[model samples]
Target chain A: MSGTINHGLAQLAAVDQGFFTDRSGGGCIQDNKLFCPGWVADNYDRYVHPTLQHLVLVGSAVAAGFLIAFALAIFAHRHRWLQTPFLAGTGILYTIPSISFFFLLLPITGRGALTAIIALTAFNLQIIFRNVTNGLRNVPANVTEAATGIGMTPSQVLWRVELPLALPEVIAGLRIATVSTVALATLAVFANGGGLGTEIVTGSNITFKTGIIVAGSIAVIMAILFDAVLLLIGKLLAPWKRKQALV
Target chain B: MIPLPALTLPTAAFGLFGDAFNFVFDGREAETGGVTVGGTSQVLDLAAKQLEVTLLALAVAILLAMPVGLWLGHRQKGEFLAVSAGNAGRAIPELALIALMAAAIGVGLVNLVVALAILGIPPILTNTYVGISQVDRASVEAARGMGMTETAIVRKVELPLAVPTIMGGVRTAAINIIATATIAPLAGILTLGDFIIARNVYGDAGVLAGAILVALMALALEGTLAGIQWAMTSKGLKLKRS
Candidate 1:
């Protein structure tokens, strides 16, 4: 509603100020606060972002995507009839190009965080679903049977046995999805969702400047940080691997 | 909302002038006329030419990545540098890197290839790393224990085991590179994206047409790679064919 209008107007204003205009001489003159000149301001508006907004968009997408993936993975595994078709369907969804999906989804959902989340979630499902299915299925049948014999219900078996066993692989999938979603989230910038890509696109259209480079670098750095954090989490969760307990 | 009619009117009118240009000076590269036909023709030619470059870049990337990735997989900690460097590499956007490279080496395909090469590296590296790392440890140890040399172990055990995963990574990488390659037109190399970007400047129809072409090109590439990936990786991997 009101938020969409403001977002559009802001982007339009950014475009109109000639800030994203060809080399130099625009509203950017007053905001020469950019880190570099000529080389940076080329498309300043597109690249510039307040750090909080960038993190919030990326963080929320990753968190929500993880939850959705977890639920779908469990649903697919419990119902054999649903497993094959569910996994295959997500696979096809994975192949759709991001921009086309964005455009297609935009008409239905409109351009905003929701569209970006839906798009990213769809892209991530295949990987997460595959990993979760494999992780649970790979859990030793002996272990599941032992739990059942011990009078555990299916839910108890899943919660207490299967999930713990599958945690390592599941975490690995999450790591991949996190890094991927962060990078893909940049495309949302085109819809005026605000992230690192805005800087890169704006920088290219204007005189190349350091601000644009910095912003772009920051985006990359954020992605790297996300990767590192996920890797660390994977390591922490899989201490058995560190202990040399299993292959 | 400009609506469809408003968007269509100008391009439709320009279509008449473009048609006239085709009628009068279509064949000759007449130095004197302000014929719009040349622009349209050049755009088409450039789109095709860019495709050729894309194929070249992709072929080169695959050829180069295969050996390097396979080699990296044999080591105990093969993914160390690949993952770390790739994580860092993702931070540097293709557009910035292209500009920096174009500035350093000048424009055209050289810059495009170099930028694409850098762009192409991460997926190949990550895939090779992941694929090789995922190789069954016992199978690898068994090969090593059988008096197989390190090279033999790689060639016989690790590589075959890793092929599917590595190929999957390649498939993903190829799609990514193709999608990003559209930016090459901005560097003044007239790829399909040039039409979209240029038309974006002119009006929506040109941009729309450009979008259609780019989408088709990307879809065709993805399908081709999917087939290739299926052929290469389907041997042992129980990938449910879509």
Candidate 2:
């Protein structure tokens, strides 16, 4: 029991001392290099691993959000009475500040990736759900009528006609969710879910400019990269939009 | 550090919600150095600070972005600028912007306000531009044919018509600013975030109470702004609504 307490205290001491001091035998400002490449080189595992973890956290949350929100959107669409309550609930969830959401989940999930992903997934629901419903609703009435007249079942019409027509808006929703999630996932560090935010938080705590710049730039770059890729996917998915643009 | 104990799912969930309720209703005098509570005055004080930061940032963003967006929209120019700026702003994470500002300006209220102002700008700017450009071009043309100057056409016809959309943008910006302002404590500004950031000192009760407070404040701001948005809409616009 005493040994366990000592281990906990040591960990606390290390956090207080700052990770840089504990790892590099000094502050981040050794030899006037704003960020010592040597230190980063030595600590490649720290940076690289966190970046990958950040990607996994964000990717899983977006995927989970898409599946859940899509299912909810379909259910709400079929039953008109459910739409209002469903949207209102997700809107309330989105309105809760990200920090509050994280702490609210902390006790139940503890400090880990699960907590971060769940919070992130909740945030994505409003955007994805709204867009999915809007897209399906925007499908022209005549198209659905024609599908039904051709002996298509309601389910068949949804799969063959409505979903295909709704693909543009759905993909647009995905782009928005993907970009915002990349940004919000940085908060995962506070929840003990390792991500680029870990570096930002540590840098801020220690006043390390190099650490802040490197991590901050990487996060921004990641957001832009994800956004661009999603935009490309959006264009590819909706080739008619490209043809319209050409005209 | 609290020792880990295995908890059933129901119990953990109950504890989470129940703890938050108790913190707001039954929390005792704080034994910490961060956010003090047990009295209305302390909670009110932090809420005021949070509002001040949010309002100041939002005001600055409006001052800077609104005129440019309005002019560009009136001229029907800079479509690329408006779209790209909105996209770029959305792409930059709020935390990164805050950290960058802290590094550049050093930690303080100023750093947080600057970062948050940048966050608030895009929505308002884009909305203003879209709102103005989307005004009935026929009305603008009619005003011009009636010998109204470009400025007069914009002021008398375009601006009033654009109010709903512009207000829509402001609503979005206001909510984003209010939500992001919770992070101000990290930049050495005392706000509701102090409750969560100093959880080790304030304990779970303080953290939960803080979360509840922030959530309530955000909801109140959103509700108030939505009311304003609705009130500002012209009756004609309301009648035209689906």
Candidate 3:
């Protein structure tokens, strides 16, 4: 695992050089192409690092969000009275604009991955919490009753029966949160968390079309990839859902 | 004791919050280009610009997306189109879209509006499609049986039934656009983002004030839409659900 991470980091270093370093020596014109291949060759690291950083921001945020949201959902499910307040609070949190959220955390976190992750985690809460509670609530009462009748504890029923039934909606929520986080993670660069947004911002500032396209495309591709992966996980976790082609 | 990151704790966060409060309430006069700029009035002006950008984008998005979404939903023919559009929308980050547009078109209000409008389309489109499609087939059939034309059935039956869901979509789009418009400054369009984006010029207080205003704007819009959604939901449907 360390070896893979090290290899990834090495590639990211290459991408970083591509992004921050000036390749003025490389001619802008080659075969009349607007984007110079020589420049790209010199700056490969620029793309790799930002892309990896973007994924790291998104992945960690989603994982943290899921844990928090899952706990909240379970708590709310057990104590129905908490449901309204929990949803309302998270709903309010959800509406806090992404960029503003980042800035709000900036003072506390001081511009880094921590602030970005915290803000991104907060953004994911409403989606994940709503979906999780909905999923748990949707688990048929009869199944739980049967489990209880068979001498299973409440925890056992929750784990074995309810959770399995709830997997589809839970995974659906995960998919949305993951995709949205991947998209939003681009803003992490504004917090100095470093992501593909840096490339786009720098590219736009300098009017570098190749940098903008490469970085923006990677961010979009990352979003799509995460969505696809979550969708696949959902399918695998709940094979029964495969019969019904609902998104 | 374990080492903790700065500002992670509530005490530290609240301290920063206090600084933000002081900045907004008591900070020195902010000047840009040798002219005083920061104050309540400036924030309000920026708020108006933010609203203008958000409203214009939403209007265009609704115009572009609603008809196609409604038509496809009514026919139940373009599920692929609706799904693909929604996915594509979700897959593109707003910042990247804004940056790409800024790069391609150069910075201006029109460019910002176009980027934001694209961001606003998918939610409205998907929600409209889902809403109309989810309307009871029996109700649609009854309208048809009563000698209602296809258009008439859609207008009188399907649309009314689908109002809440469509409104929900609109609400989502509106809020998304509002949040996204905060980044319009990067495109050289002046909005609330100007304060946050130019933190050095505006200071931490200005950034905090901008953040607060943006949050308030988003919350107000969300609450207003939620209220509208509640009001527009048919009484019969509410009763049925309860």
Instruction: Give the candidate number with the greatest lDDT.
Output: 3
Off by over 4 Å in 2: A1-44, A203-206, A243-247, B1-38
Task: Give lDDT tens digits, candidate 2, residues A140-226.
Answer: 999999999999999999988998788878877887788778888887877777788898788337356566677767777888888
CAPRI quality level assigned to candidate 1 from its DockQ score: incorrect
Q: How many backbone clashes does candidate 3 have?
A: 7
Worst 10 residues of 3 chain A by lDDT: A25-34
Flag the better candidate by TM-score, 1 or 2. 2
TM-scores of all models?
A: 0.71, 0.86, 0.89
Q: Cα lDDT of all candidates, in order? A: 0.63, 0.78, 0.81
The stretch of ten residues in a row with the least summed lDDT in candidate 2 chain A is A238-247
TM-score of chain B of 2: 0.89
Candidate with top TM-score is 3
Instruction: Please give, for residues B73-177, the per-residue lDDT of candidate 3 as tens digits.
Output: 999978878867877787778887887787667899988899999999998898899889988899999999999999998889999899887997798789789
Question: Could you arrange the candidates by TM-score from highest to lowest?
Answer: 3, 2, 1
Cα RMSD for candidate 1?
A: 8.4
**Residue A197 lDDT in candidate 2:** 85
- TM-score of candidate 2 to 2 decimals: 0.86
RMSD (Cα, Å) of model 2: 4.8
Local accuracy of candidate 2 as per-residue lDDT tens digits, B1-242: 11233333877667766766665556355665554463456667788999999999999999998998899999999977876777677667777677667655778887788889998898888888888988888998999999999899888899889988888678767877887788777777888877777777667767777878888898888788878878877788889874
